[model samples]
Target: MKKIIALLFGALLLLADTEFAEPKPSIDNPRKIVFPITHGDDESINHVLSSANNVMKFYGPEKVMIAIICYSKGIRTLLKKEKKIAARVRSLMTYDVEFIACGNTMRTKNIKKEDLIEGVEIVTAGIVELVERDLKGWIYIRP
Candidate 1:
């Protein structure tokens, strides 16, 4: 009976190890991602939205965090009249995506702080934010 109990215990240990085998890709945690949109065109905005959707699908919303920096002409994509893109932005926000706009651009373009559409945050400098994200190894896409 003693020998039998030892064999069973060893087998249980082996099974436990196999059941909790390490994951592939060897990641310590989910990767970081950032996208900068510098174009106000509808097509370009849609492209960024699509890319973000793909990332969320693969990584799961909670596992990945995305920051979209809008500066220059791209700030128009956050306007209330951008209905199509606005809807897409709303959908992405449900998954915790963040939209950042450049405060300097708003001043230069004479766009009021209140003029930005819902779900957008005004940042001090869009370019600086982009650079900081890049340094942290977040994937950068200009769409």
Candidate 2:
């Protein structure tokens, strides 16, 4: 009787975990991903791009929607002067990946729209955008 009771409890816990499990990507539906970048280093920026590239490759560009949000020092990754990585950025854009620049960081860092890459979008706050996307069931990745 005790063994049966323990097994029942274990089953209940498994059921509970599934009830609150994180959302999984669906091939039939558009896979949503939001990556928040707060570091300005080349290594960090490259990782973010590589992850997005891998996901798009795996899912096919049309099947996945990717957004990379930059704030703090990370905003440098989207600047027009980021020559070292500009080509890579443009390459990702061809896959329809979005690059978001935080307006608050731009203001503090004195970055204008012209200072950013042509396709970059400006959002009021990066953290808030990440939070909203996560709550909406989008996968969040930071590298």
Candidate 3:
């Protein structure tokens, strides 16, 4: 029984150390990930940003393509007024993370392009962008 238990433990450790599957993320065949932020609260925003950073660290920036889509109240994350959070977003952008804001949300909130952080891209609808990216095989993660 002890031998069997020891073997199982070894197997578990081996599995934990197993490498990622074929096509194995690379600059050309990068893992595509999209993170959607729909809540404006600082906690939620920070959580999502942390999640993205963790992923980037695990995969190495060169092996992954990351996009963050913000809409509704979440649009606040991309606003210049967000200050600290906006700075964090800009820091991630330095590693090539793409940040997108919903145009509809801007119209509803009466926010203008100049109101957002310098590099955020504007999309007509954040949800639609999520859907299209999902269809194109991008992994969608909501943290």
Candidate 4:
């Protein structure tokens, strides 16, 4: 009975480890940063992108893991109809930057996966995603 309980607990621990889904960090990229965007303005989006760009430039692409989580109006940044910022987003993706969209906003705004840009990942809740990343030692940037 003791061995069975230990094995079950181990399995539960392994499962718990997989709860926070995001890009894996390594020794090469020890710094993790999460950008939380709730406003859909172009300036805000660009500012966040610029900050991310600066970080990458400072640390070199291989030394940083950056993720942008968009919720509420910020989802506009990843919309398929959003062409103005697509170029900038695509440019960042080249350096392994991640863009995540909020499913709650998608449901309220009627946005489907096909409605988002090619590489945008959809998470259940953008704020929750931000919290998880923040708890996992990621620096939070509002811009």
Candidate 5:
């Protein structure tokens, strides 16, 4: 009887371990986030960047991927000549936050490609990119 009980207990422990083991996150299936910054001012833009950085800090880079789409007046935030918020924007790159500028907005505002900050990539349209990201399960953030 003692031997049977011990064997059952060992089997139960093995079964529980397999059932309750924590599942690991897949790097290929990371969480997606998109921040659409349409504001031109320092306060709103900085708030958005700060909030994005906070999210990255809380979630860790391994589990989350971040993208910022700048369009319309928000394109002004990425001007290389404009030193304001440049450091903060640069810092986010280290956390894997990608900054995408709207090509249409650049042409509409008469801003040249050379005028944009170094790390920003030019997308066809900011709104279009955001929508595509939404389709791919990215959560939208407007701050």
Candidate 6:
């Protein structure tokens, strides 16, 4: 019985090893994830940031690509005026996390490119950007 139990434990250990499916994530083929932030509230913004950070921590920054698409009220998160939040964003950017802003939202809210944090990419439309990324096989996460 003891030998059998040990054998079973070894088999379980072998099964516990991490496994990746087709197109496995690696330095050359990293996992792509897009996060959409539509809410401007502090909690919501922080939550999304936290989620991205957690993913990076799990996969290691080099093994994963993360993009945060901000539109509508969510554009507030990319504003330079959001001091605390902007700092957090900047920190994430160091890890290669991309933050994208919607041009339509900026125009609607009278927000200029200079008003946003340096390094933010502006797209014609945030929703459309999300759609394109999805179609490209990037995971869409709304946290």
Best by TM-score: 3
**What is each predicted model's overall lDDT from 0 to 1?**
0.81, 0.88, 0.96, 0.86, 0.84, 0.97
- lDDT score for candidate 5 against the true structure: 0.84
lDDT of 1 by residue, 1-143 (tens): 99999999999988874232234212355556898888888888888889989977876776677888889989987777777877888888888799989999999999886777777999889999999889987878765
Candidate 4 wrongly placed segments (more than 4 Å): 1-29
Q: Which sequence of candidate numbers ranks them by TM-score, best first?
A: 3, 6, 2, 5, 4, 1
lDDT of 3 by residue, 27-54 (tens): 8999999999999999999999999999
Give the residue spans of candidate 1 off by over 4 A: 1-28
**Predicted structure 2, TM vs. truth:** 0.80
lDDT, candidate 6, residue 138? 98
lDDT score, candidate 4: 0.86
Q: What value of lDDT does candidate 2 attain over all alpha carbons? A: 0.88
What is the C-alpha RMSD, rounded to one decimal, of candidate 1? 11.8
Order by lDDT, highest first: 6, 3, 2, 4, 5, 1
Q: Compose the digit string of candidate 6's lDDT tens values, residues 1-143.
A: 99999999999998896777878788999999999999999999999999999999988999999999999999999999999999999999999999999999999999999999999999999999999999999999987
Q: Which ten residues in a row have the lowest lDDT in candidate 3?
A: 14-23
Tell me each candidate's RMSD, in Å, in order: 11.8, 7.5, 3.2, 14.8, 10.7, 4.9
Q: Kindly list the per-residue Cα lDDT of model 2 for residues 4-98, writing each as its tens digit.
A: 99999999988874232334445567789999888999999999889899989977887789999999999989988899778888899998999
Which 10-residue span in candidate 1 carries the lowest summed lDDT?
18-27
The total number of steric clashes, by the backbone 3 Å criterion, in model 5 comes to 0
Clashing pairs counted in every model: 0, 0, 0, 0, 0, 0
